[model samples]
Target: MSDTSERNQAVQIPQEAFDWYDAYAHGGMDRRTFMRKLGTLVAVGYSMSVLTSALLPNYALAEQVSFNDEDIIARYEVFDSPAGYGKGKGYLVKPATGAGRYPAVLVIHENRGLNPYVKDVARRLAKAGFLAFAPDALFPVGGYPGNDDEGRALQRELDKSKVQNDFVAAAKHLKSHALGNGKLGAVGFCFGGYMVNYLAAVDSDLLAAGVPFYGTPAPKALRNNIKAPLLVQLGELDERVNKTWPEYEQDLQANHVEYHMFMYQGAHHGFHNDSTSRFDKASAELAWQRTLAFFTKKLA
Candidate 1:
């Protein structure tokens, strides 16, 4: 079958992606080059103009986020985790009003680590009256390397057990932080989204709500352990992630897990990250609104 025909199953990763990835991994190519090349690989057979246009905006991680630094108490903090792997670092942002405790939301970044866009996302969450923390999954490897390829490479070296612990610890800390009212929620995109799913499943008692954007859901084995409500946003064009949702949703329903899912029409993976041209603005905004409403309701 052609690669397109196997979309219902696992789509094969392109050799071009592997080539660029390898080059980037070995420091032979910069992040921009790798991403551009990877984009071409993703839309194999597409015209060069279309391919370049689709991926450039995404690599530009600093899109215009409305919230200014003054709007929030943005800072870098070293947090203690329950997992005890070691102290980890992350970006913490909250409303500048700084008057009293508020609901807390843990922001997990895409595979690229806690880049400017993800930090901007934390600011957005703060504007919505939640304390947001965007943890660098690569923190233990000396934090986000200021290079996407390097950051991704560092991220691959993490111990899976430690990775989960870091998030769990961050959630545990955020929920009980001096700025928290004991309610905690999480939002993650791409890789981070899947982590949010993992967080929801294992640390259900700590997480009140979770929003996973284009992320994989926790496996069925962990379904019964989920106590928090979930808001799953899916892009219609992302087959790999979409293929797993049906079964996961069935498990959620069977386990009586409180969950809601929305499929954005004619969207692709990473649609919520406006830094990418693949982003569907209308759908992204709608998804964000629903995320806020759901978190407010569930975490309240």
Candidate 2:
């Protein structure tokens, strides 16, 4: 079958799925005015997804692709870095079907560590035509924290210098991979976002694009060294870091860098992680669309 036929066969959503959506809409907004406004928002979101999926070949292909843990082509491995983080490890997810050279993406995990969510992001990139490498930034620190409470405890013990070394090692490993296209990009969430910015600032030649979601901004002096196109997504109501994003954005503009900045009106810090209670579906979906487009334009 043709790719389009395959996609059409794979992308169908059952009619029953819409029933929950209908009930949620009816239950969430009692006022006609509120319901109308929400309905319009939902319509716009739906239209964007449909149009985007139809227009982008990668997006269409992504819809038809599925991955399971057992399907991983490259196994996880540990590496020694000169930056003193001994035995830093990373997971590599390669395309299951392709035989040719593929673009590479470096995925950095949030403070919570390299969990299933980070793995899913790697798999998504692979499906979209890139080989994804997600390094376990916490391996040197004796593994990532288990939960918010435990994560905080582990965070206090982490060595910043070691983490930087781990990132550098991860980037180098991805760049040297057999399947890697040698054109690399980086994407990070929360703490990983900060690392992405730092990597872009220090190792511009290693990355063609950088996407940081609710990440800490690089120092003003380092901004001049950023050689990659940057796409930053900020959450306006994020309790932790929203207050400083505007000033940071100004710094990017002052440096005359190519950048795209977006602020989701009421999203929280972890909005992109579906497992989080703070996950804002609308904002997350839009941010993801922007991310894929940005990577396609800059790295592809």
Candidate 3:
């Protein structure tokens, strides 16, 4: 690579993520597959190293939870997806010491399944006093299998409508859980963020609040169907997602939808994901804090 070429490459978000964002946003690919493609395209160099790091398991996902199991009652459970798509599996997390019903949060993961980072997000919610559950969107495909490429391939094969129904089912399950206080809220990142936007755009009685980080808007037609309050977070540097915001905002207002948005000046897509270089700790922390406040005010 020439000096100018190397400088340009270094200045951009990893070359690996160029197509990943659009693919994942459209529900066409997964993060693992993105990294794998990155590795293959750039045989040997710094690019290859980036690919390796991106695919590595983020075992140390959350700084707050520290993988501590005792703080919350965590387990795997099956939820029904009525679209004839079969059962859905997820990691259910709640305050271990809490007694009595608590507000429930549907924690949706990125395009990938319920990996460690997402599971830890659930734990973080648990710590904040919400009964959180992170569902594996790839459950029908034999689960995540700890491989991104495989996960993306499976994610692409999903029936979009049925998959959405599965997410709704997860919310319903949490709402009806004995540990739940009946109210429900949702939070999602990346692909999951789009899911959050989807839920908000749909007329679901099960959802009371939604927070989508760096996600696109719901389809233009569904804007009026939103009955729940939404706190949409955005990364200023994420052109793909941000580019649609203006039009989305107009539609939301025209429909009188209840929604709010926050954009971090220097943050890029996936800024809230702690596992990757894309993470912006300051912005992520602020977004999370705002989410907690939103859920507490709306769900509690």
Candidate 4:
């Protein structure tokens, strides 16, 4: 079947199934329970295998820009994060043929650490003419474990504060890197989204721009600390994350933070991610276009 056919089939999945999957993805539900609950969808004519295949991420489809793309160079790099995790590692990508320093972007992954989707995002950023790095928070525990469930479990075992510090350190490292123009921007999804908000909150000097996709907002007190321009992308149906936005907007307005928020009409949480059924192509494309434009206006 064509990819479009598969996506249409995935769209036939019930909303309840997506909710169950989202709950499970975020750790609110265990795998056994998730699988069992998801199995209930079998009554609707979806075999368990088809349900799993349609709901889970297919990394093979995640790449919009190839690692070997002529426009960018990609590789692994390690950096020190003394205050956070001791040693941090990540995938770094940058313009292959550019001579001058480029504005750098730190790509923060979801709760599952530095997975392929996030790496692909780094490559996309590089192709757009920026130095991009995606640090693996699970590196201290042996890296992504080759699967998201295990990866999420590994991330949960780490000291949350240390992980946050690691990202903060990453932003600093890339901003000061020899190949960078000294301006730093960040983009993150899910847990990474929260981290982007956290980064902008704690460090005003490093991040010049930030795009947080449907992640939770920083605490009200910390929200006042943000000084970077923010382009917040949210899904209209993601109530779990959306409930936190009103006060967040008030805080941003009260503090005079430069930010714009767009709530995609029919998109759900994880809408920007194309590897799963939750991906909303139109919304994701529009959001990304806006994101790149915002970066150009602010970072370039």
Question: Residue-wise lDDT of candidate 1 within 67-124, one digit each (tens)?
Answer: 4566777788888865646887888888889685888899998775787788888888
Per-structure clash totals for the candidates: 0, 0, 1, 0
Top candidate when judged by lDDT against the true structure: 4
lDDT of 4: 0.89
Measured with C-alpha atoms, the lDDT of residue 202 in candidate 4 is 90
Off by over 4 Å in 2: 1-74, 145-148
Give the range where candidate 4 is weakest over 10 consecutive residues by summed lDDT. Answer: 44-53
- Those runs of model 4 whose alpha carbons end farther than 4 Å from true positions after fitting are 1-4
RMSD of each: 7.0, 11.3, 4.8, 1.3
**What is candidate 2's CA lDDT for residue 11?**
32
Clashing pairs in 4: none
CA lDDT scores, all candidates in order = 0.76, 0.69, 0.78, 0.89
State how far residue 250 of model 4 sits from its true place (Å). Answer: 0.6
Per-residue C-alpha lDDT of model 4 across residues 171-205, encoded as one tens digit per residue: 88898989989899999999999999999999777
lDDT per residue as tens, model 2, 79-136:
7787747677887778777784788889998764676677678877777767888887
| Residue range 27-120, candidate 3, lDDT tens digits | 6676577657665657645565444344333445445585566777788999888773779999988898868598999998877677778888
